[model samples]
Target: MTDDVLLVHGGTPISGEIRVRGAKNLVPKAMVAALLGSAPSRLRNVPDIRDVRVVRGLLQLHGVTVHSGEEPGELVMDPSRVERANVTDIDAHAGSSRIPILLCGPLLHRLGHAFIPGLGGCDIGGRPVDFHFDVLRKFGATIDKREDGQYLTAPQRLRGCKIQLPYPSVGSTEQVLLTAVLAEGVTELSNAAVEPEIEDLICVLQKMGAIISVDTDRTIRVTGVDRLNGYTHRALPDRLEAASWASAALATGGSVYVRGASQREMMTFLNTFRKVGGEFEVDEDGIRFWHPGGPLKAIALETDVHPGFQTDWQQPLVVALTQASGLSIVHETVYESRLGFTSALNQMGGHIQLYRECLGGTPCRFGQRNFLHSAVVSGPTKLEAADLVIPDLRGGFSYLIAALAAQGTSRVHGIDLINRGYENFEEKLVSLGARVERPSAS
Candidate 1:
């Protein structure tokens, strides 16, 4: 695939309707869960994103059959012929995504061993794999850090145990869920991440004959079964993507109707958006997001885990906040390096200042640390077109939004990185009347 460039003619509002598929965070993990099943799993509403393709490749490497169903965006995964894959091929995928770490549990159950290559994701923070190995060790898996990658071997059947997270890491929680579902005994997890995607994964597992329960609090109980069959389930919509487009609409002074967006998953974001002077209408099919014909209001915001405002939603919304009437503060409590993207925004004529001290919300892990995870935006600043580089997934989309909201033209490099999360983003942008052009190959 070519690393293409997008020349965007700015100052035009992106208005129209675009539909969202399954949650990118959830669908790939659910596909990995199919390895625990004795039969084939049919997953509906699967998006054709790079992350999903990477997971599907990893799955096929482990001898699972991955193919599409009759309907569009449907994947039929069959794991009957489970086998080990070549480590070199696995290493090749390591640089593409961090998803190979998630294959550990399912591979352990099927082959009694697994190899995880050097993980790669957005350069947002230190996303260590220690939580994964620590959880695996508790379940009787022997871990060794080799020169190439981390290797694991399960001497016996994994036995469930009570585990509590030091912090509610989403990946660690998923590692526990996928491992606990087929372990020898009942596993109880406290301080688990109850994100909607996690809950959807649990629903898929339940459909596959695994018994799991979630409480009002952040506690989950899983009763391991000797065997699990395949499941047929539809995935939840991508709230992150939905909110990204909503922020785009707000930033560009436009309107967008995102089909398949769920009201329940985005309640917190919706309330926050309304507070920031955005308007929306929700119905059975989807939601319509628009700017209310006035300067957007500046509001204090904080990024947290699920049930709080999402960290992914913060980046795009910050672009809209650049057009807000007054000062807006955002304290990022998730990734330590997430605020690094603000420098590019500043280069594009947005006034955003980074600070080490947590300013707007309660002190988080990054508070007082050297990392500049907090930002204050003095908005109603006119954005000017500048050559932009795609930072991370969310940050890249935020740049696109900023470009669209700016005057004149902007050249965006590394447009391909957006494919990891957003599906057919260029096509979607074109559908919404975005004046973007991709240079042809010489």
Candidate 2:
């Protein structure tokens, strides 16, 4: 809790019933696909965030084990002692994330040589683990790149490769399905990233036996199998924290049930939250969202990859498009610095602007690539509260949905970077009523 400081207050409206777990992007890539199993897996609705305690402390520093599963967001792991750690405990979790470069292909297929280190995440993008070490040197490994991080080395026993990305990257297509599910023969790929958390990490690597397929255009093949085992599975329910509490229940008009929200992984963020007027219902378990009292409509949108429209649900639906009404726009074809957190929603008054080009959508690849990556946003604009700071993890939950739809007291400072993917977010923002505190140390 390094000098944590929230102290919210503001307008308030966050209605109740919250319960989304699992999927801070598919439970840390299904705990790095349980290190390409051989025995112990399990997992469940896991999500205590901070990137699942930084991939469960880099899977207990590569020996795996990681117990606890009688229920209550289970997680068993084990990985039959897949050892090889300590480069000062993998550089003491380097900058503490970028999931140790997706555990460098299940630690070079369970330890032939690994040690990644130095990687950290969430500046939103330029996400270059050099295409996860160029897809593990096209599945043959042997990397080296020193200075403190990349060393990898399979030497000989990782084959598969056909590649083709250029950009569909859901973390370089889960680092080419955790290194082509144990590389050896057929891998394919081509513009990958079919995100439903990479098709639930290809159903946790086809229940850990692997084979994989998926096509409808953005290819993917896999194949390579010699052995793989453990898997109980369950995860798959955080549609980016249920579209960030359905864009904080349409930026505070409020309703928000969310309860393990899924409506088919939130049908393109509930059809762009009902084209911005926002009013949801769904229910085979959850998805309520609200705000239907009037004027929100603006839209235009873009952010593709996965069934499209999700650059992490365009920063909590761009703080509910600043109270929507007229011109919304967006574009952001996925992280070219994710619209620089709309410059703190244009300093909380929220008019937005930011452009570089690619405006009303399409034209992407960050348009001319100068990269403001488009925005616009006008709107009903009235927000007020200021002092924010927390900048990344979906721009710190879109600055806690613009300080709970601002009007006065904010102070938001780094909110522990929204607990690195929201779980227990100050007890789910005090069970959604959200007055929020933590101040003290005068």
Candidate 3:
């Protein structure tokens, strides 16, 4: 047994309280936004996750002085020395994260050139960087693809332009926002992703003296400024992490209070959870979720952009749906290969079937594309423990939920992958009374 393996004794309900700090998606981007400023910026409610560490390292490498603030989960960053820094060993970050690519605009603004190493993220689909490069090109940055990485140069001051995204992608939208804030002139972005995290990022940029506005019709306009100061802002709680815990409580027939969870961002997920026979109560501090002692109802769910079912919430909820009374249909419109993790669930006695055609929702990009992006889960089946391998961040959490809801002992490998998003999850599991142990140490 290796250090990454966990032994889980199943049939235990996960009960207790766990606090979620800043969002994994938003915090890193906020850190990256600090590079656009001249003075030190303070970010509160930051989570201690692997992605945060990765971004912090990248920032430090770029000559940004990052240090702990007075409070826990607070970071103060100074980007004054960024222009004088000589970046080396950048390829060491290659295949580690996709974040390095987002550094192009800020680097190019400070220093006329930037080098982006090979990017790597979850193997869910062909998450190409075309949208990013295209947006940068529209902002007057030239990109040269090399064998090891991509080199970008801005011959002059970047000027903003009009951009209409082919899809309302979160990453592409973020790239445009980060790049457009410092560019010259006005930038109009149509069909932008308006996720709460993105809105928070916009707020961060606004505090730093950037001119940006969001219209009702999924459009955003950013007017570039000559200089920007620092900002003091608190990040929003992790709604995706909160939903995962809610699904865990439902799957294990337990109750959990997720402290720091906000209700505004989770209204859609809460409605769907209620429809599935789950119960939840909202308070000022956080939200409490439970199974509510009944047969879980089956429902059709479709993953989409903001104001729709989130793609990140689908995997963990699918584990809970296996206890539903009938068939549950899931249409994945976000990532083409997201449903591939269902094969591991079926290995553990789940009756989930995958299909190439979209079943419960309108045809999406993956429909008729030969990708198994749809799933039919026939549930009320007893789940037995089996050896499992963690696939991705969300899928790894789902496997942990499944193991806790199963009937026997199970071995879970690659649990460290969960640290990329979840903060101190093993400690949280223990606090929730889960019977998990390091196999080698145990």
Candidate 4:
């Protein structure tokens, strides 16, 4: 494997404008939802990322014709000729993404049986596929585990049933939504994840003639439909990407105008940014975030499912918190090993301490599980450049932020991994006046 590396010259503020497209989280799922339709679906505002490419390849392997639309970032997917793919071709995508698990539902509906290869994603925590299989099993699908992968067969029509997730897992909720939409009866799901991306998927499905309802108590009810048609809808802006840029601006003491960033979806993050002495202005086009000229204040924060500080936003913001004046406490409730990335920050001259006990407002599932999910960040320390390696998507971006804010140049390895989520990130960084360049192959 070719490991792509970037040389980053530090101490430069990232000041400029960049545009964010459809959410990385929502776009891929929307692409998968097209398999449930009888006709072609048009998805606008799609970001060109590795995950999208992975899904597109998988869809094409299933005989779905995917082509670019007239407009930029638009995808036209026709699933009328969907067919079973070669097992070896399907296994080639194994360990590349977790999207294959989602294909089981739509594939099971179209074809009698579906084969799922080994799934892989960011090594953040234990994101088990048990929630997915359990929901499928409740819908009357039989799964057989083999050495290569899991094979699922639907002898009869799938019937929707009631399900309550142990946690508000975004993936499991999506599984329930995708499977329940085509089942025989109504599916009532409690303790569901109500993230904006999930709601957007629901909207996409609704446009495709599916009946779904959401309640204030995190409950969702979906009545299965016999048939679904194609949908033409523009996806929501990527709030997670917007927040990453916002955090980059705050960390480097610069200003950035993120076009296509919606304030409604990022209200919680904006509030937390202001609390940390970051300035922002929201208008019709997008939101402009900058570090106000002052010592950044420290605050306590926690990660929760929807309407709370997002776990994805925690890593980049932690880089900014390292520049704050005092102690900043962060509790990561979503992923157990999410805070482990801070050790690299400590290597870069930031003082951050990890703890097993919850350090923020609420105690979480990881509190008593011996997981180091909490952090104490002491800031106002001068950050110096160090040799850094990209960990995961969010953690990799955090390392970039740290490198840009530090005093000297740093070499960042495995930067190709960032393309899985962020689209054209290196170009965007350069546009923001960040001194980043790929070293010539020696």
Candidate 5:
């Protein structure tokens, strides 16, 4: 049942409002950055999700003092007691998320060693750590892969240097941030992923006294600082999670108000939502999106790193796209085999077909390989509840929305998969008036 999820009966249009918690993209790294700070750092508006719990466990294993802060989603980590790290418990986090790899640089700098468990994210592509290792090598860390996990060590003083990435990977870029902050000299990162999460993480580091700057394009420049003090920061709310809920509104023909969601961070998604006949209002607290009337329109969507249509939004939007009047073209450029999951959607009475050749009018990962890069969803398809398996993070949310929009109850296993990125999701569902409940696996 590692990947099984259970979603209950279909419901009418979800009304009322739901608030989002802190960003999953920023919290763990902010916690890791606390080690560089000399004082206790307070993180406000933290989510009580599983990934945050895992990071807290990792920080505790490393001898940091962590506990609830003043606010509801607040977390405080004092790394003053952090001397050495015992990575034995890291195995439990292996296959949980891609975040543990980001701990390597911080651990290596603080304790001269690091043990990284395996990583798991969306099963969309081969998310490799080659760039992470390469950047660490730029800082003079020796990396060795063992049967169980990865062992990293640094002999000399940690020094920063120039490095380039083949792709703009969010996790890899974060690795650079963690390692470079306390490093000896200046580090310039090229081809970096410029997601809003990255911007927020940098803001947290700056509050902790790290001299970092983002130049034109996707390059980041970080000048090494000897020490960083703890800081009090409230992370940005989860943009992807907000988009997921908005997609649920479209899929179920309902309405949802995402409190604390940011419109600037997700402008492209919001534009697409409006284009698909969805309506939303930008307010001080959050954004609201709803399906106006009739079937949605088939539009071309491509997954990019940031400042473009997000890859994380692809699967969830697909459910809404199924209601479009014509064939919707989705080009997954970030992850290669993201199309593989659509076959399961097709099994649910949807008219979705996959293509290995780039069908979105662009050359993609599948152009040369066997990877399916495109999906053609026929319009106004009715989804029937089926036994659903949680493949990954975004896919899991897609299934949840699909199940709620369907006419009948859906027994979806792997409910815990929502914990990876979303905060207080069940409560949010309840607030949105969803008829959801947990049951033992059948």
Candidate 6:
């Protein structure tokens, strides 16, 4: 795969308006959930991304008819004519993304069987699928491990049951929705993840005629229905991507208008932005982000669920914190190994120290041992571009922003990883007037 990308000289501040599209987090899940409809489903404002393409290909493999206009990223899926699905090919991408595993319920409900390839996400910690399996099993699905892949079969009709997740994992919570929506009765899932994407999925499903209720206390109640018809709804704009660019505005001492960005979904991030001396204004079209053209003050930041600072937004924001003038303490409660990227930043002359104790919020998964799950960043140091590799989604974004803000040119490898989430990121870079090139691998 061609994974090499280069970022040339910075010093030039990005001064333009960028229009944000649909949320990458919501589009793919909505696509997979479309399968549960068993009819034609139309998704509006879908962003063009690799993961979305992968999900599309998998759905087409199962005999679903998918169509869209040449230019509009909108999608339409007609699942009535689902053809032959090559599960082997789908499995090849299992290690590529985490969303593939959530397909088990819809595939089983439609085809009576499911063959999952594998799953991958941020390498922050052991993101297990045990919770997903337990929920599916509770719904009367039989799961089996095979030499080639994992198979899930529903020998009898799935009956609703109470499912309690050990952690409010986004993936597990989605699996519950996918499995329980069609199970024989009402399913109550407590300790559910309240991420915006989850809510968006519920919203789309509701439009498709599914019975669901959301409580303020993070409990989701889904009443199983015998059938779900196709739906046409617009996907939400991506909050994580919006937050990344907001960080870029902070790190580079620049102002940018992130068109279509909604402040309502990012209240926690907006509050933290103000605390860091970043100024923002929300208009009808989008949000504008800028630093006050002075030293950014460091503040305590913690990663949490929706209505809190998002864990996925942590990496890109960390780069901004490195530009802050004082010690910016960050407690990453979602993933322990997430702080590993700090060492790479340190190599580039950033002052960051990691720790085990939660420096800012409620204790989380990594509260002890050598798991440096928190970071103390001291900065305003000049950054010089160096050879770097893209580690994960948000980290890749931070590295690019750093390159764009640094002096020398930067060569970043494994750039294809960013395509999994960010839609047309390279094009967006050029739109922002960045000097970036993706050289074909030798």
Q: Model 5, residue 101: displacement in angstroms?
A: 1.5
After superposition, which runs of candidate 5 have C-alpha atoms over 4 Å from their true positions?
1-7, 361-363, 440-442
- TM-score per candidate, in order? 0.98, 0.35, 0.98, 0.99, 0.96, 0.96
Candidate number achieving the greatest lDDT relative to the actual structure: 4
Off by over 4 Å in 3: 84-88
* lDDT (Cα, tens digit) per residue for candidate 2, span 228-324: 8989989888888888888887888989888878788778778888978888988688878899887889988888877877788888888888898
Off by over 4 Å in 2: 1-16, 24-30, 33-68, 81-104, 107-130, 133-135, 138-153, 156-239, 251-254, 257-294, 297-310, 315-323, 335-357, 360-364, 368-442
Question: What would you estimate as the lDDT of candidate 2?
Answer: 0.83
Kindly give the stretch of ten consecutive residues in candidate 5 with the minimal lDDT sum. Answer: 1-10
lDDT of 3 by residue, 185-299 (tens): 9999999999999999999999999999999999999999999899999999999999999999999999999999999999999999999999999999999999889799999
Local error of candidate 4 at residue 29 (angstroms):
0.4
19-57: candidate 1 lDDT, tens digit per residue? 999999999999999998999999999999999999999
1-442 per-residue lDDT for model 5 (tens digits)? 4234555687567777988888888888788788777889999988888888888888888888999976688888888877666555778778777777888887787789888877776676888777788889889999899988888899987898988877788888899988898899899999998898899999999998889999877889999888888898988888989999999999889999899999889899999998888999998989988888887888988877788798889999998888889888888988887766676677777898887777765435557887778788898888787888778788888888888887788877677887888877778888889898776655
Model 6 lDDT per residue over 84-171, tens place:
4786777767776777787889988888888876677777777887777788888999989887767889988889999887778888
TM-score-better candidate, 3 vs 6: 3
User: What's the distance in Å from true for residue 194, model 6?
Assistant: 1.2
For residue 332, give model 2's deviation from the true position in Å.
Answer: 1.7
Pick out the ten consecutive residues of candidate 1 with the lowest summed lDDT: 1-10
